[model samples]
Target: MMAKKYSNKINKIRSFALALIFVGFIIMYAGIFFRGNPIVMLIFIILGMLSLVFSMVVYFWIGLLSTRAVVVNCPNCDKPTKILGRVDMCMHCREPLTLDPELEGKEFDEDYNKKSRQTKQT
Candidate 1:
């Protein structure tokens, strides 16, 4: 059996933001090839700028999430890490952690964090 793979929520979001920046830069660079067509070039440049702005928004959201994340000492890695929800993996070791006792021994699932699930339980 293959071992389950999980990434820290904050790390995942950070990587997504980094990827977005790269994509934005690439888009802007592609605009250089369209210099002969001023309209097309302008469109490319605007699109690239929008992508970059969206990435910035995502980065800001991560900052807010970090403030709400629960910091705990990872048992597997023996390092301090933050858990964002009921199920989150250790930043250093990828070990699944949970704050809810009922989910302590259960498999990790992102759906556990959904509002609909919580409502059903109640």
Candidate 2:
């Protein structure tokens, strides 16, 4: 069976924020086509601005969450990385890491972070 790919939570959230910015700009640019209708153009502009504002909020939230995440040096790459949950991939090498000893040698499964899943496994 093929293994599932994983990414650092921080990087994923950062990428998502970047995507929102692009989407917001695209939506705003689309408003140019509706120049004939002031109301329609205004609506599009507002929606685009909302997307940007929400992206900023996401960025801010992620920044705070990142500060609280545990930082550890990846054993494989010897580089520092943050772990958001029980199982997270190394930001630099994509190596799987875990704080729980029980999950140390197990396959990299994101489900290990879930309380219900852990309970079921035990």
Candidate 3:
């Protein structure tokens, strides 16, 4: 079996926000089918606009979080990337990264980032 691939948290959140934008537009376009029924069309359009507004909020939130994230060059790819948690995949190469020295050179596991897990280890 192939190992599961992990994505950087920042990239993942951004991707989700971008997808929401597309979904919102698609929903609005679908409203065109109900043009004869003004009420239904208006409802669909309103829902789509809500989705778009929510996406904008998400983007803004992530943007602020990104400014606070740790930036480091990936050892594998030699490119700058942001790390959101203790363990995160590289943005350019998906290589596992860690801020804690104790966890270095070990198998990549998301559980390592959990506070409960670290406290147990200690």
Highest TM-score scorer = 2
Q: Alpha carbon lDDT of residue 49, candidate 1?
A: 93
What lDDT, from 0 to 1, does candidate 3 have? Answer: 0.92
What is the lDDT for 12 in model 3?
85
Number of backbone collisions per candidate: 0, 0, 0
Of the two candidates 1 and 3, the one with more favorable lDDT, higher being better, is 3
Quick one: ranking by TM-score, best first?
A: 2, 3, 1
Q: Candidate 3 lDDT, tens digit per residue, 7-86?
A: 89888899999999999999999999999999999999998999899999999999999999999999999999999878
User: Whose lDDT is higher: candidate 2's or candidate 3's?
Assistant: 2
lDDT of 2: 0.93
- Candidate 2 clashing pairs? none
Candidate whose lDDT is highest: 2
Candidate 2, residues 4-115, lDDT tens digits: the string is 7789989999999999999999999999999999999999999999999999999999999999999999999999999998999999999999998988778888888889
